[model samples]
Target: MRALFCYFSATGNTKKCIDLYQNYLSLSGVESDIHNIDDGKLEFNPEDYDMVFFAYPIHGFNAPENVLKFAKTLKKCKEKKRLIILKTSGEHLRINNISSYSLIRILKRRNYYLTNEYHYIMPYDIIFRHTDLMAYNMYEALKGLVPLDVKDILDNKIVKLKYMPFGHLLQIFMLIEHPGAKINGLFMHTNKNCISCGLCEKACPTKNIEIDEKGKVHFKHSCLMCTRCAFYCPKDAIVFGLFNSWKVNGKYSFQMPKEEEVDKHKRYCKNSYNRYFKIAEERIKNQK
Candidate 1:
């Protein structure tokens, strides 16, 4: 079987999950190709593959803007193609499940049916950074869970979420961030700490960031608010406008660090995060 992975990853967590999925699927005898949705380019036809995986990060309780736009551009498939959704979020809130509502609606109209939907918890790109230990654990959980999920797909297991009432309304409401992000992008400014290395400009998926000849970074109104500019900033220079306080910088090493070497977060989202990890652990063990 052949598969296509189309994804939008801001801080790389969702992309990491895609890599894991692709590797595991290959082990199951499936060949796959990848499309980065942020590029606004579709290199392969969905009909050419047996299945298409839509992978992305949950942004503002919804799929990022580029993903939705890309879905609309897909040609209407004559044969119903299977589309699998894999979303990554910082925490495991039920509300996060609604992120796929808009993307799924657009795809279904183009004749792509939802086959399976899976959610994984990754480190935060915004709000607050997860400790290295937590990030490591999340990565490990992702590694363990993806193989099992890939096996289920190979076996034709119809794993999908039940329909939710008023899901459309909720998804529409969450889309406020769509326009809000563009406006918010205008407010992003660099502080003295910025080295004018032009890193943010090159990293911006939307090309919303630019560095002038005089070494000043400017943010455009086209921002998708994926936080790529801020998260990957070498000096943590980009401030997130109104949400500057919530900005999380630096890449996740996903490496095992000694527990004593890392500082622990003070039980923030304690119950929810704990429950998520616990459930993931159980799933991994039971599958074993």
Candidate 2:
């Protein structure tokens, strides 16, 4: 069966998992193609492929807006038998709520059966300045949870048992709602090292950072705090308190590519920053 694996990865953590899945799929002899959703538009007849796997990061406990748009567009097309969604979030999977459930219902109406849903943890966003080493450890722990026979489970009617649900619930409540929860402190002040290149704004998955009319960097409340922008920054101006100094020890070791290299990675289809800017501008105009 032909399978298409489409994913949206901002910090490369999701990409690492995708790569692992691709390798495993190749070993299983399944014909598959993997593409970053940001590289180009996904225009395909759903009838041609037996399965569609969506891998993306969770934003504010929901799928990124672009992924949601893509899912809606797919539902408008021909029917498909199996649809699987895998989300990578710093948060646990059990908190998968009404928003995610609603998306599944939309797909069901369009004739795609919900096969399975999986969630994995990743490093917290540095932008939010809340780095949880425990979350990173949990992400690493998930490597052991990968099923030996993903293909066998694909067409199975049962939602396979995976993850610790109670653990996930506890995590969600403690991390998001608990008053005593420690903040990540990701958005520290910009230093003289900043070049005003606007790379941070473009690299951010949430479109949280933007250049105001005064040409200063501004952040919105919608940010997921993913550190892709800061970690990917050339000048190293963005910091997360002491993390900056800690990261500096590994300086020249991380090998962050040049701005051109970053621009070429194609994580978002077209530059989402521009689209978000236009939307923000329209909202401000309407408010006035």
Local accuracy by lDDT, each model: 0.89, 0.55
Residue range 167-258, candidate 1, lDDT tens digits: 77998999999999998888899999999998889888888888999999988889998899899889988889988998998898999986
lDDT of 2 by residue, 1-288 (tens): 677777888667677666766667677776778767655567656667787777787665555555655667664446556777777664443444322444465567777776776665554453222223333334444444434326445446455324444644443443352112113333444667777898888876556678776657766555444456667778777764444543321112222223322222234323432343344345445544
**Candidate 1: worst-modelled 10 consecutive residues by lDDT:** 258-267
Runs in model 2 deviating more than 4 A are 75-77, 97-99, 126-136, 149-157, 160-191, 196-198, 201-227, 239-288
Q: Candidate 1, after superposition: displacement of residue 157 in Å?
A: 0.7
Which candidate number would show the highest lDDT if scored against the true structure? 1
TM-score of 2: 0.60
TM-score of each: 0.96, 0.60
Q: State the lDDT at 189 in candidate 1.
A: 96
lDDT for model 2, please.
0.55
